[model samples]
Target: MFWRRWCGLFLDQKRRKKSDATYKNYKHILGEFVDQLPASVRFIDQVNADVLDSHMRYLESEKAAPKTISNKMMVVSFMLKAAGVATPSKMMELPTVEEEIPEPYTREDLQALFKAMTPEERVRYTFFLDTACREKEVAHAQWADLIDGKYWVRKKTFKARGGKERQFSPKSHETRLIPLTRELMDMLNARRKSSKSQRIFPNEWGDPEGHFLRKFKAVAKEAGLNCGECETTISEGRFTKHPAEVSCLTRPVCEKHYLHRLRKTCATFWHEKHIPIRTIQSWLGHKSLETTQKYYVASAIPRIVPPPCSYSRRICSNSSTLVLLSTRSSLGAVRPEAESRVYGFQ
Candidate 1:
C-alpha cells in the first residue's frame, strides 16, 4: 500500500527528517539528471561514475553554483547508496569547492535585524543560526534544558535515540555543549513568563512546523534581517536588492545570493572571532573539519585584527612592538628573557 511519489524508494520518515526546502531543492536538482535520462538510466544500476559526470557537466554549463552541485550530488549519491547501488566517484570533481566569499552581516544589519525580531523569535532564530541547531530543536527549546551558562541542547523533538522524546546535545554539535553567554540567558528570562509551555517557542499547532524556508524568507525580508540581498555597485552608491536577484532595491544593482549567504555570514562572524576550526566544525555540524575548512575558504572570514605591518604606531602598538623586537635582535639580545623583562611577556 504505497502512495504516490513514495515508490518505496525513500521512506516518509527520511523525507520528513529533512527540512522542506532542502528536500525540495534536492528533488529539483535530481530531476535535472533523472528527467533527462531514458528509463534505463533511471534504474539504480545505471548510476555509475560516467553517468554522474555527465550530470555535473550539465550543471556547470547551466551555471549552478558549486555548493548547489555538491548538495545535489550528495542527494543523488545518498539515494543510490540507499538502494545498494555503488555511488560513482567521478562526481567528486565538483566546481572547485564553492570559493565564493561569504558576506558577513554588518553591525548595522545585525542590530536592526535583532531589534526588529520579537524577543522569542530573535532568541530562537539567532541561536539556530549561531549554533547550527536543527530547525526542530530551536522550535522546542525549553527552560529546563537551557542551563543558565553551559553547553546544552536537549532534543525534545526528533527523538531517534530511544523511547525518550527529548535528548540533550549542544546547540552547535547537538552532541555537546559549547558555551552560553548572558545575552542568551537574558533573552530566555524575558520570554520566561510566556515559557509556561515546555517549548521555548510553541507554535499554536501542537506539532513542530516542518516547513519554514519560505516563511523564513518572508519574515527575514520584512525585517531586513537576511543578508541575502543582492548588492549592486553603481555610480551613485552600492545598495542591495531585496529578497531575490530578480528585482532591484535601487537602480543598477549587482547580483548576490541571499539566505545561504547568511549561513556563510554566520560562519564568517564565528571564524573572525578566532574560534577554532573544530569549534566551527561543531557549530556548523559538519562531521569533518575538512568540511569546516571549506567554509573558512569560502567565507574568507576577515581576521579580527589587521596584520601588524598594516597598522601604524598610532593605530596599533603591535607594530611598534615589532619594530622594537627587530632593534633588539640587531643588538644580538634576542632571548625571550631579555624581551620579557621589557615587554612583560613573562
Candidate 2:
C-alpha cells in the first residue's frame, strides 16, 4: 500500500480514539514526515531503517527540540508497526530529554500583569491563579461544578447553540476537587449574581471563551513584559508574495506570560507552605507524584529562615493580601508559629 494511504488509515483509527487536538497533532506530524520522504520511497514497505535515520537527521537539522523529535519518532514508529513493518532496534534509540524546571510568575510580574487588566479580567485571572486549573478546565467551568465550597474537576457535557452536545474531559481522565480561598469564593459569588451563562467565564455567545492566551499576551505586552528579542514571520495575506518578519518588540508576544504559569505558581505556593507531595499531586490532578514534584514543587523550598517576632506584610500582587507572621517563644527564642496567611481581595 502507498505510504500516504497507510497513514490515512492510521489517522482514521486515531480520529475515533483520540481528542480533536491529539488527532490534529498526529496529522500535522505525520504530514511533515510524509512530506520529507524521498520521491523514490512511495510505499510503506519502502520505509526502512535508513529512511527513519534520515528523518531523524532532518529533524535535528531543523533544530527541533529533543522532546519534540522523540515524540515525532514515536508517532512514526507506531505508524510503521501498524503497517506491519518491523522497526529496526537501532532506530529506536531516542535522544535524551531533560525535564525543564518550571518558571512560575514572580510577585512583581503578577502585580504588573494584574495592573494591566481591567477589574473583570483581574477576577478571571485570579480564578486561574488561585485554583490552578488548566486552560480548558477553566473555560469549561460552571457554577454547577461547585460543591460544598470546592470546585470539582470532572467530565462535563456542554450544549452549543445548535443543540450539539460536546463532552469535555480532564487531561489523563483524572478528576479531583480543588478548594477555593474565601476571597475567591466571594468574588465568584458576586460574579455569579450577574452572570447570565452557566459558564463562569463565557463569551458573548454564552460559550466558553477560547482566546485567553491571546488576550493574556496582549495584557503582558501592555505591561511591557514581552521579551523583545524573539522574532516571527507574519503573512499579510493568503497569496502575499512576501511575509513580513517582526520582533516581539513590535507585538505583545512573550513565552513567559501564560495561564499554565499561574497553575505552577499556585502549586509552588502550596509547596512553600510545606504541603505534602502527595497532597500537591492530588490538587494538581497529576496522575504521578513525581510529575508534581519535578515540575511544580521542586525548587519552591525556602532557602533562608528569618528571625521570629518579625512579620512581613505585602499587598498580594494579584489584588489580594498576604501576611507572614512569627512569634517569640516563651524561652526568648524566635520561631515561626504558623504558615503564612493569604487574604482575598475585598
**Residue lDDT tens for model 1, 1-346:** 1111322355344456554545666666556656655555645655566777877777778787888878777766766566665544444565567455556555445444444454445665555545445565555566566663443554445443234353334344445453443344445677776655665666664434444344454445655443445553334324843443233343223243234445566566556545567766765666877767877675544454432211110011232221111111222211111111112211
Model 2, runs deviating above 4 Å: 85-90, 160-165, 235-242, 296-346
Candidate 1 error regions (>4 Å): 1-7, 10-13, 16-32, 39-50, 60-62, 99-101, 118-121, 125-137, 154-174, 209-346
Clash counts for the predictions, in order: 5, 0
* Residue 250 in candidate 2, Cα distance off native in Å: 3.0
Error of 2 at 120 (Å): 2.6
* RMSD of model 2 against the true structure: 6.1
* Model 1 lowest lDDT segment of ten: 307-316
